[model samples]
Target chain A: MPVQLAIALTHLLSRKRQTLVSLTGIVLGVAFFLAVSSLMRGSEGDFIKRLIDNSPHITVSDEYRQAQRQPASERWPTGAVELRRVKPLTEVRGIRGHPRALAYIESLPGLRAAPVLVGSVVLTFAGRIEGVTLNGIVPDKMKQVSTIEDKMIEGSLEQLAANPNGIVIGAGLARKFGLAMGSVVNAASPGGEVRTLKVVGIFRTGNANYDDMQTFALLKRAQGLLDRPNRINRIVIQLSDPYAAREVASIIERGIGYKAVSWLEASEDLMSVLLVRNLIMYSVVSAILVVAAFGIYNTVSTIVMEKIHDIAILKSMGFHARDIRLIFLTEGVILGLIGSLFGLTLGLGLMALLARVELKPPGATELVFLPIYWGYEQYLLAAGFAMASAIGAAWLPARKAGRVQPVVILRGMG
Target chain B: MNPAGREGSPPMLTAERLGRVLPGEVPVTLVQDISLTIDRGEFVAIMGPSGSGKSSLLYLLGLLDTPTAGRILLDGRDTSGYGEDELATTRLRQLGFVFQFHFLLAEFSALDNVLLPMRRLGALDEGSAQRRAGALLAQLGLDGQAHKRPHQLSGGQRQRVAIARALANDPPIILADEPTGNLDSHAAANVRQILRDLTRELGKTVIAVTHDLTFASAADRQIGIVDGRIDPHWRA
Candidate 1:
């Protein structure tokens, strides 16, 4: 072994109690850092997964991002043509030539698009009335772009194809109206058209508000009741890779000349909240390691003080200042390495314990295990930060040891 | 006893008007205007009262401390331009030191203590260095105590281990600062004889600082210092 490292080991071994205490500090710090970070990151990942799974990756609405230019302004270049208080053209309220837009959207790779007509309607049955959102859908196309099929408790979306006037109501709506799978209800649109629709499907989405106020029916039947034909106001898109939503949404908006909002864009405020939460979590955990580094500084500094005479002897025997410095630095490094190894093992154990814990959230029906992310980067980060702290703690005492003057020490002895 | 060097060869160590001062608001002079030379294979003693700067002069000569006013020449080479690292290397390869105290690292065994300089110099492989440390310990009559730490050994044995360490790198000059100050009479005599034999039998230069007149009498020449200057009247 090198002389410096050998001396470092000897110094640490001689102070067993102090060394062990400092080592334990590092171990606990690292273990806690890993466990807490894993939980935070795991929950964040789970939340994002649920968000992406339940909503459309992109929603292309039949609206322009900017107001349309008048034809006079388009025709005259550099002409003095400022127009004020000129009434805008009133046009139809739905996407024009939506079939062509749908075709263009479906041509893109890795996505499925379905056109939807949505309007508010009043349902009446047995001297009871309730207002609900009515969504007009092509059942075959809708299944490809929606998760409503997964939430079905009674009939399937395919039943709407079999029964032309069928509508799917939420479980809350069914309970409120005392309706069965084959019950009939009168749905009246704001445009004064009415139709009697049968309840063919009931779904429970675990969201009380959505379950109470949303209903779906076939596109033909909804158009007949709502008095609007061949119109769709929204195109919902699902992507194979949800993370590509922002890019795909922009491309769709450019192609269809409408406003497309990606799920990421729509939930940007929540994303920022998650980012700030992570920053706070990492800083809080890193503070533990920083506190542990102080333990190392104390231990190493004591060793340097106790070994002052030995330092004088070594210097007089021609050991360089850097060699003296290296001895103490080596002590810190050894402590860091050993502590990280044990800490990581203990952290894995903690993560395993956390992953096995089962708890039911408030208002939740089922028990869920705590999520723990076992990513390799967190391990690397923990170990790297620990080593840096150890080295940093050792630097000051090592430098002091190297600067010892042998003549002064020997004269003092005399 | 040759006060001047041998006729054909340069002196092993030379100091020309060497001076050292501790800087402060009121500066203190530890050593001043000192000039000396010692030949190869000579035994010399520097005798002085307390605070007379003999240890400070020894430190300057060993290159353990820099001289503030004048230069030191080791084997005819001017060392004025050497940096701290160069000085340390020069000391490692060319000079050895033994102090008033044993100063052996308490955690290391006697053999390991002797091996420190050889390992730092890296002039020998590990096997050769270990063998040489063992040989030096045995030569100093410390064969049985080679594996003992300083705290486990007697005072005389610890000093002998320190002497062995001084000879570890086989430097031409060995500087001793009160090498036998802490020993009993018998141990002091034994250490004195061993230092004498180093010059006579092994052809090594040995310079020692001592207050013991009996110990100083063993050397061929004695240089006395009063108030940091050489005093010709105060001799052994």
Candidate 2:
């Protein structure tokens, strides 16, 4: 080995207690950095997954982003055409040429599109009345585009297809109205149409408001009850790669001239909140490494102080200033290397322990395990940050060591 | 006696009006206007009282400390403009220093301490450097103490180890500051004889600072210093 490295090792080894203390600080710092970051990122991923799975990736609605330009505006092209009191003509509130639009949407690869005619209605059963949202769906297409089929507890969405007037309601709504499978409920639309629809399926999604207010029925029957023939106001789409929704939604809007909004655009506020959460987590975790770096600085500085004579001797023997600096800097590197080794091992163990921890949320029947993301990138990030901190801490003392004058030290000793 | 000595042998080391002042609130001059030359195969001693700057002059000549004014010439090269790294390289290749204390690194074995300069210079591979270090130690009568740490060896043994270290790179010039100042009488005599033999047997130029009259007598020439200036009339 080179003498500089040898001397550095000797110096650190001789001061065993100080070296161990500094090492312990770094070890704990890095371990906690990895463990906490893993948990935070894991939970973030879990939330995004729930957000993506429980909702449509893209929703193409009946409305246009802007009304069609007036015939007068188009005829006079560069002229000032400020026409006042312009009112739209009364017509059915649904997308025109929806069959051709749905065909265009379905042609896109890796996407499942279901046409839904959603309407507000009042349901009365046993003289108990509740306002609810009724979603009209094509059973087979909805099964492909939604997880409601998987959430079914009593009957299937296929039953809604088999029975023309059948409906699927949440378990919460069923319990509130004391309704069950095959029970008939009177549904009244705004057009003064009333229908007695049989409850074919009950689903519980663990969301109280959704369970209490929403129901699904066949598209044709809904169109009949809602007094609109062959009209679907929305097309709900699920993509194989949900993150591609933004690009696909824009393309759909451009192609079909209807407003298509991706889930990412709709939940932009929530995404920003997650980003702020991550930033806070990183800042808090990095503070630990910075504190650990201070311990390293203290230890290395003390070593430099105690070994001034030895430094003088080495310098007198023709060791350059950089060599002296390298000697002390190597001490920091050694400590960082060993500390990171043990820290990574401990961090993995901590993550495993965290992953096994169970928590029972209020009113929940089962315990949910804490999420721990086992990404290799976090390990790399933790180790890189630790080394930077260690080296940074040692820099000042190493510069001091490099600036020592051998003659003065030797004269002082004499 | 410009480039070489009286015998036409090239001067191994030269100092031309060297001065070092500690520049501060009240400037203290450690060495001033010191000019001297010691040719190859010369053994010289500098004798002075305490605080007379004997070690300061030695440091200047060895290039361990830079002169505030004037210059040093080693092997016909002027070194006044050399940077710190260049001076260090020059010292590693051409000069060696032994202090009043043994100054061997405590953590390293005697052999390892001797090998330090050779390792730094890197003129030899690891195997050859190790061999040369062992040979030098054996020649210094430290045959069985090569593996011993500084604290484990006697004072005399440690000083011998330091001498072995100084000779590790085989530099023509070896500068010693009171090489026997910390030794007992018998050990001091032994160290004095070894430094003398280095000039006689190996043709090495040696300059040492000492207060022992007997040690000064063993040198080819003696120079006395009083108050940082060479005193021409003083004799040992």
Candidate 3:
């Protein structure tokens, strides 16, 4: 071993109590840092997974991001053209030239798209009226784009293919209306069209509001009741990689002149809020490491103070200033290395403990374990910050030890 | 104005108008315009009263402190322009120091203390360094006390361990500041004889500061200092 490292080891070994105290501080700091960060990031990942799973990756709605330019504005670019008393044209609320658009969308690889006609309606059962959203879908196409088939408690979406006037309603609404599968309820559209549809399917999505206020039916039957034929107002899309939604949505919007919004774009505010929460979490945890570094500084400074005589003798024996500095700095590095090793092990144990904790959330039928995200970056970050703090704390006292002049100390010794 | 170490066989150490000043509010001059010479294998003693700057002159010659106004030379090379690292290197290879007290590291054994300089100089392997440290301790009559810490040894044994440490790197010149100042009469006499033997038998130049008349009388020559200046008429 180098003489400096040997000196450092002797110094630490001679003062075992103070050295262990400093090491304990670092270990606890790193362990707590990793534990809290892993838990927080784990929950965030779980929430994002649920968000991506339930919602369509992209929704191409029958609307433009901007209104169509006037004929005069289109003809003369950048010209100050103003027309007075111009009224906007009214059109049917459905995507125009939708067949060509659907064919174009289906050409893309690793994507599934389905047409949906959604509108508001009122349901009356035994003179009890409740407003709800009505979604019209083709059974086979809807199966590729949605997970409603898996959520069904009674019958599947394919049953609606056989029954022309079938409707699927949530368990919440069925309970409120005192109805069961095969029961008939009167649904009235805004255009004065009414029909008695048979409830062919019942589903429970575990969200009370969605379970109570949403129903699904066949596209042709819905068109006949609502008086809009051969029109689809939206295309719900699922992708193999949901994170690629933004790029796909933008491409579709540019191609078809509709508003195509990705789940990422729809939940942009929630993403930013999550980012700010992570920043706050890291700052709080890093503060613990900084505090632990102070303990190292105190221990090293005391060692320097106690060894002033030894330092003087070594300097008189022709040890360079930098060699003395290296000895102390080596002490800090040893502490950081050993501390981080134990802390990482403790943090992993904590994560394992957390992963086994089971809880039943309200309205959930089964127990769910706490999510523990096993990301490698958190380990790297924790160790990196600890070493930085340890080295930074050691620098000041090492410099002080190096600047000790042997002559003055020798004079005082006499 | 004559520089030390310029005579026959080229004195192991030399000083040229050596001076040291404590720069502070009062600006004290510790040593002033001192020029001296001692040939190889000569044992010289510097005698002075309290606060007479004898230790200051010794530190200047040992390269432990930089002279404010003059230069020193070891083995005929001027050291005025050398940086701190070079000066330290020269001190490690050419000069050894013994302080008034036995400055052995308290945590180290007597053997380890003797090995400290050899380890720092890295001139030999660990096994060789250990053997050399054991030999130095045995020669100093500390044969069985090599593994004892400083606190376990007597005052005289500790001083002998310090002398063994100083000689570990085998430097040619040994500079001691009151080598026996902290010991009793018996220990003092033993330390004095050991230093005298270093110059006479081993051909090592020895310069020591002392208030003991017997220690000064044993030297080849004795110089006296008063108020930071050499007293020309004083002799022993």
Candidate 4:
């Protein structure tokens, strides 16, 4: 062993109680840092996964993001006359030539697109009336882009294909109307069109608002009832790799002349909230390590004070100031290394224990386990922070030890 | 002329009007305008009353403390311009020290204590350094006590361990400050004889500060100090 390190070990071993106290502080600090960060990251991952799974990766709607330019403005180039509140030209509200658009969108690799004609309708059953959104879908194309099939409780989406007048209602809606499979209800559109449709399927999506207000029917039937034949206002798209939604959405918008909204763009506010939450969490956890560093500072400072005479002797024996400093610094680093090793093991155990804990949230149908992220980056981050804090704490006392003058100490001894 | 002294060769150590002052509200002078030279392989002693700057002058000569003025030359090399690291390196490779107290590190065993300077110098490998430390302890009649801590050893044994440590790097000059001041007569006599033998057998230049007249008499020459200056008429 090097003389400096050996000396450092001896110094630490000489003060067993203080050394152990400081070491315990570091160990607990690192352990809590890992455990808390893993839980936070895990829950964040879970929340994002649910969000991506439940919504379309990209939704290409039949609307322009910006107002269309007037013919006068286009012809004048830089017209001195600025137009304000100019009335927009009125047209039928739907994607023109949607079949051509759908074909173009489907030509892209790794994605599936489906057209949806959504309209609000009032359903009357016996003496009760409830307003809900009716989505027209082709079962074969919709299944590729929607998770509604997975949410089915009674009948299947394929059954809607077999019965042209069939409709799929949410469990909340079915319960409210006292309707079951094969029960008929009057669905009336604002265009003075009314149809009696039989419920062929029931779904529960775990969201009360969505379950109460959403229903699906065949494309041809919805078109006839709403009086908007051969028209689709929204093109819902799903990609194999959801993270590529932003790029794909932009490409679709550029090609189809419609506003494309990716799930990431729609949830930007929530992502920022998550970022702020992460910042707060790191600051709180890093404060623990900083407090642990104070323990190291205290231990090393005490050792320097107690070993003043020994320092004088070593200095006179031809040990340099740097050598003396190195001894104390080595002590801090040794403590940090050992503490981090134990802390990682303890943190992993804590995560495992947390992962096994079950909780049933309010109104939840089943128990869910606490999420625990087992990423290697968090381990590296915890240990690196620990080492940095230890080194910073040791530096001041090490410098003081190095500046000890043999003459002053020896004079005092005499 | 002292028989063991090399009369014609250049002096091993030279002090040119060395001065040291403690700067404060009231400046105190520990050593001032002191000039001296000791020949190679000479056993010299500086005898004086308490607080006469004997230890201060020794510290300056050993390169443990820098002088406020003047210069020190070891083997014809002037050390006035040397920095802290350079001085420490020079001390490690060239000079050794024994204080009034044993000053052995309490946590280290006697053998480890002796190995400190040799390890710092790094002139010898670990095996060689260990063997040399053991040999030095054995030569000083401390072979059996080499593994004992300072607190576990007797006063005399601890001083012997200090002496063994001073010779660990085989430096040419050894400086002692009241080496036997805390020892009983028998132990003092033992330490005195060992220091005298260093000049006679190993051709080492040994300078010691002492108040013991008998100890001073054993040296080839005695330099007396009164109030931080050389005093010819002083008698201890």
- Residue-level lDDT of model 3, residues A286-331, one tens digit each, is 9999999998898888889999888889988988899889988888
* Model no. 3, DockQ: 0.67
What digit string (tens of lDDT, one per residue) describes model 2 on residues A1-414?
Answer: 887888899999888999999999999999999999999999999778867988999999998889978899899989999889989798888889899999999999989999999999899999999999999999999999998888899999999989999999998999999999999999999999999999999998766777889999999989988988899999999999999999999999999999999999989999999999999999999999999999999999999999999888888888999999999999999888888889899999999999999996554334779878998999999999999999999988999999999988988988
Off by over 4 Å in 3: A75-89, A125-128, A152-154, A171-183, A202-208, A359-367, B1-9
lDDT of 1 at A58: 94
Ranking by DockQ: 4, 1, 2, 3
Model 4's DockQ score: 0.83
TM-score of 4: 0.94
Model 1 RMSD, rounded to 1 decimal: 2.7
Model 2 alpha-carbon drift over 4 Å, by segment: A77-87, A125-128, A175-180, A190-192, A360-366, B1-9
RMSD to the hidden true structure, all candidates:
2.7, 2.6, 3.1, 2.5
* Overall lDDT per candidate, in order of appearance: 0.90, 0.90, 0.89, 0.91
TM accuracy, model 1: 0.93
Each model's iRMS:
0.8, 1.0, 0.9, 0.7
TM-score of 2: 0.94
* Candidates sorted by lDDT, best first: 4, 2, 1, 3
- lDDT at A293 for candidate 1? 94
| DockQ-best of 1 and 3 | 1
- Which candidate, 3 or 4, would have the higher lDDT against the true structure? 4
Give the alpha carbon lDDT tens digit for every residue of B1-236 in model 3. 21334445555667888888899999999999898876777899999888989999998989989999878877777889998889788878878889889899888899999998888999999999999999999999999999999999999999999999999999888999999999999999999999999987877888999999999988888989988888887664
Superposition error at B150 for model 2 (Å): 2.0
